[model samples]
Target: MKHPTSYRTSIIGRTAGRLGVLTAACLTALAVAAPAEASTFSYPGHGVAVVHDRATTHADRAHPDQYRDSFAIHELGAVFGLGADNRATAVSAGCSASHPCRSIALSFQIVTMAGSHVRINATNLGRAVNEQCPGCQTLAGAYQFIVSTPAPFSLDAQARNQLAVIHHRLDALQTSNASIDDIKQRADALAAQVKTILDRAAAAAPKDREVNPLGTTGPSVTMHRHFDGPS
Candidate 1:
């Protein structure tokens, strides 16, 4: 007759096999649920580029000088505009008093990845005031960034962080009715989170281990990134 212990071992092995199969099925489900997201904008090869014109307009009108400030916030980082123009031109100071304003055409490329998160390395192609010459009207202001997400539950964490920041900004703006402040706060927070995720992912990777088992080994996730253009 077979020993009881031997029979128990056989049973245990069968159970382990079933558990592995279940785990694989769950992972497959997660991968199926995860979705890819992206956004893009195109600007005319020529003309001025405007960054945060809406917010800047308010700031310029509110402040003594026609000075306005804006920022491009992404999950990876944020870029604040020191100055800008409607047409693609070299970053220049305020238009001369004689030529207070200039009309310039522009195009834009904006991509948002995942529902609440923005990716870096997303390219922005447009023309604005040339930063080199604060007063010159030449093709200027072309910004590019490399936005990266993290591994090991990185996507989920980033999404949560972004949602939290969005809610906080919405609340603050609604309470004070400060549109610019609200936008800025939300943008900054999102950029910080994206950067954090990317940084963490980079750090987690081993120098010699090119393969990130944590990101690819497990079940996948569903993600969405949203983008809205100028109305």
Candidate 2:
């Protein structure tokens, strides 16, 4: 007769080996599944209107009395999608009221998206404003019609404005004569500060809220459907 202890040990070893193999297979399959690609779609009857105005008064002797006002308007129709992590991605084509038919594409991992409160903040500096000359006063403005599914998705304008200001400051610093290292340090610091503020605000805001369902007779697009249509 076989020893009971030996048989138990053999069975245990086999079970362990099977588990290991299964774990490895799972990991391998995930690796081969490919990074999720952003889906592209065209939105019909959707539009976005953005307007910006800026004014600057020179404080320097050479241009002490110089004042300049810049105005821009952006209009577009675009589509938005949610990533696996529930972030927002957008693609649009339209002209600012001032310009015409300029293409716009925005992709950012959303930190939070729920109810009337939708916060989409990104760490990218590309959208920062650039100050061409020093010692010049500057003012800027921007507007956007965020088209998202399920209608009634709203953003915190205050947060968006603060973020824009941060970017503007960073851009202004870049035009300064400060050393590259110094600029980078300052930029990083500013970025950190903005991030901290955003974090705190997010934490303070209420997480749970009532969400308006799709097809509720509000906006044309009511349902927040999958980025890709039903396969």
Q: Where does candidate 2 stray beyond 4 Å?
A: 1-111, 114-155, 209-231
lDDT for each residue of candidate 2 in 1-231, tens digit (9 for 90 to 100)? 211110000000000000011133433333233232221111233211111111222222222222121111111212121111111122112212332111111112112222222222111111212123332222221112223223223336776576556655644542355543454455446545555545544444432224533434222211111121001
TM-score of 2: 0.29
**Worst 10-residue stretch by lDDT in candidate 1?**
7-16
Residues 144-207 of candidate 1 have per-residue lDDT tens digits of 2232222212224554465345434433332332333333445445445544544454444332
**C-alpha TM-scores of all predictions:** 0.25, 0.29
**lDDT (C-alpha, whole model) for all candidates:** 0.25, 0.26
In terms of TM-score, the best-performing candidate is 2
RMSD of 1: 22.8
- Predicted structure 1: clash tally: 40
lDDT against true structure, model 1: 0.25
lDDT for predicted candidate 2 compared with the true structure = 0.26
